[model samples]
Target: MLRLHRSALYYVRPLLRAALELTPSKSDTPVTFVPTVAGLLVRAQNENVAIEFTVEGAGSGAPISVPYGSLAKVEGRQHEPLELAATLEGNVFRWSEVGIPQVLSAPALEPAAWPSLPAQDCANDAELLTALREAAATTDIASLRYSLGCIRFRGDGGQLAATDGRQAILLSGFRFPWSGDVLARRCPVFTKLRLAATDERHVGRTEDWLVFRAPRWTLWLKIKHEARFPDVESQIPAREQADTTLSLAEADATFILQKLKHLPGGADQNEPITIDLNGSVAVRAKNDSSSVTELVLSSSERSGAQVRCCSDRRYLQRAVQLGFREILFRGTAAPLFCRDTRRAYVWALLSAEHCLKHNEQATRIASPRAATAVQWANSESNSGS
Candidate 1:
């Protein structure tokens, strides 16, 4: 028999929703009620992610396999305690409120069928969330290549990175305590696991699974240790190694992003925008349909170099959105680089005439030779910690 407050179920409802989101609706055993020394654990799993959380219930019996929808339908207006009493005929669980004739019942799952829980370790939530958001920004959400689509957690340098073929983002300052380099899918589940800075979060691993425990819940996802992630550090230009640097104030960058966002296309397939950094910063975008509408914005900052380059509007907007105000150009052919205190981003540059000719199917600006662009020590001074 087990007993706990009905409000406990309400508290972990968000966690349950996150778990169910990762799995199909019709899975045989979407949720399992397990009896542990700490409390009654509600757990669920799929191929990519698993979720578990504890409620203050007391009982010992075979685990129950109830549909999440069935549990979600239970109703109680006033605060009431819930009880699950073990019975002989197939282990049925029943709960009822005081002075209420209605009762809710669910069938229990056999103990032999439930998967075992693994051991755990402490994890820093603040650092983990920050790394996930930064690295996941550039990951190809729909790519078939795991290396390009998933975020790589490397233990050696305590770094996290992700890349699509066209652009990449990397962040330092993470001290992952894993055995080696591990790859995790950029699932929206991590974004939903919101917690306070003081909450206790934990991580654990088995041979095939990586488990994460929140203050009220636990999650297990498959671990990819053998995957080969690209070397993002080598591709990014050092602060002193960029040729032409263009610095934009936050207001200027935000203005450009806001203007270019509504132009024509979505994030992946957007129109090309030309950026001219001669004596000042000038941005121009045009629509060459039946009505050729042109848009231009200029900044008063005169510290820019005399270089003009074309870039995907979405990529530029993403770079600015990640708080990268300094744009570094390695000649006109090499990739564009930008960095802040802990994050470094690099994206391919597009040719102005080629994009104009090809329309929506623009190609990368070809580089004639890999020549080291001019380096400026002053560019490093703009970076903030």
Candidate 2:
């Protein structure tokens, strides 16, 4: 019997989950049982190098020989003793003792016949490939699992959609090649497109590698969740009273974030920070503790345009760091809309309550009639948050 240390077991669990998620689950024949193992092995390709034993597994009958390239790369002594083991029972493969059980659930068998796709016929692959890379980065290897059937391509351009519940991004422009039956199959496949004779766009077959064409550029990615992405177009605000665009230098934005960093009770629901934008040219943020940070925007028109809202400072900080040229504060009560004019990116909404709690004087700002308005604003912001 092999006994793995608690730390070693923890390390191997996520690795096994990631590997298993990438493997094809549909069995042509009945699979008895497959228990995970952990052990180190010397690379046959590069015998001089050794790899740590993160995860390994075997079927019920014979020992499984995995390719050296198939293993996820980790830093450590390559020649160390690698733990390995496996068991088989019917078609289901379960991890009997891989150290971390919570990291992975038994992967369900893939359907025999997956939903069909049209065909693949595309010229440019830049957009699809880029979107894939961005999406893959948003998810961890252990959390991503999805099957790609044949993709039919048509038109001069195509679009890729990615989402993680909190945020969604859509990139458009590419060509798709259309093929009927060819697009129907459950397997990981990469689609490479020649953006230019010299430039290539590579979309990963799964999340493991970023398949793109560029000289001297190599990228790898982990698989991402394949759940249906959200409908982003529907979330855009329908109307805007004032489209105030301000291009603050990155340094200025950083300064604003720093000043607003410390608010009441940090990010709790009770200790809200108030953002007063209605003043002449200064944006004022104050907490219950009388700590006030005022940022003066470079604007000549002060106009009594002040609106008060509350938010989690951390969330706001992240939004600012995402590099939007102008922060579009739409309607005081809803999530503040931030967009980068240089790129088509929209951030997740921040809640009004989270912002409101920062200001101990939020109730004073709302009247009986205005209470309904405030509630509507908060509800909208909460939905986006």
Candidate 3:
């Protein structure tokens, strides 16, 4: 029987769901479990994404290689196959389900030696993890580019950047101070890393993998093969171009989008909504059968150019759910930069093409903290959100 922590599984659960999204065949998807001196490795790779979830030891001595199906749960030898035994508080989970063939027939990866990486103690572990989580939240898992499916972190000195094609997020001035660079020695280069954050004793990396070592918890992740991250910096619109700025409440933004989804003809993918900021904040949409006009709460910068920013209802709505207190909407066509309002560290952009770029500007939010919501990607990586 194999044993591991429930908390560790919390970190891994999202990766499993993502891998499942990669493959259409859900019935017999394979999951391989392998053990190493560091911890237990839960690995799955499909055409879209290849993810490895690692959990530090629970003092169970050595771990063995085992295979399982997506639906199978850990069970004891005497328990019925219908029952499951797993906990999240670091309790041990017993895996002994005996009925599923795929669970019994999965392949085991050849045991490879782990690489030695530079170990450093970081102070802002939780904040860093939160940043990565924010980035991962904005990533498009369904992207055709295999690299786009995973979260990318390109940091130099203290700056980090991540993007999902349509939108880009940049973060600078992190709190951690290291003798050597975290992901790599070079700066401004992209490194596809697993989303993980914690104040473990030693956090280090090898050429191919990042290893997190805690007394009772551990994570191992394989970095993406591509060395180059997309060039998002060149695409960001300059601050001066924003003809309109708004201080829309995060809750209000969420409420408006949620209500639009309920509108009879407002939620379809093909249906586009015009967020007219020329006057009172409003959402305008129409379909073959009907149309919707809803008032949104937001303060305008000016009545200058009538801004008619058009975007997919769902995409815009999803952007609002990112939980930023306020967002700065530059103008139509140009990307609307979203941020914490209280801090400059976290920021996100609505997809540039889908949202369009360069537009007639008019409208302003009341006293918006000027900044972008930077994308913080999958932390507790190896177990990412």
Best by lDDT: 1
Q: Candidate 2, residues 78-161: lDDT per residue as tens digits?
A: 323333333242121122333443212122222221111113222354455444444433332233433221122212334444
Which residue pairs collide, candidate 1? Answer: none
Report how far residue 185 has shifted in candidate 3, in Å: 19
Better of 2 and 3 by TM-score: 3
Candidate 1: worst-modelled 10 consecutive residues by lDDT? 367-376
Runs in model 1 lying further than 4 Å from the true structure: 4-27, 36-38, 56-62, 75-101, 104-107, 110-125, 202-204, 264-268, 290-304, 354-385
Per-residue error (Å), model 1, residue 255? 2.7
Better of 2 and 3 by lDDT: 3
lDDT of 1 at 225: 64
Q: What's the CA RMSD of model 2 in angstroms?
A: 14.2
lDDT by residue for model 1 (1-385), tens: 6766667666655566665563445434546777888989877766667777787777786666665555554534446777666565543444565666445566655432334456546465466765676676668867776577677776766677889878988887655556567787665566666778888666556767666667777776677666667787888989788778887665466456555665533333446766666644665455544222223333324343467777887788888887777888887677889887777899988875623222234322221111211121123234421
Instruction: Estimate the TM-score of every prediction.
Output: 0.75, 0.43, 0.59
> Cα deviation of 273 in candidate 1 (Å)?
2.5
TM-score, candidate number 2 = 0.43
Give the RMSD in angstroms, all C-alphas superposed, for model 3. Answer: 10.7
The better-scoring model by TM-score among 1 and 2 is: 1
Which ranges in model 2 have alpha carbons more than 4 Å from their true place? 1-157, 162-167, 173-199, 204-229, 238-243, 257-265, 269-275, 280-290, 294-306, 339-385
For TM-score, the strongest prediction is: 1
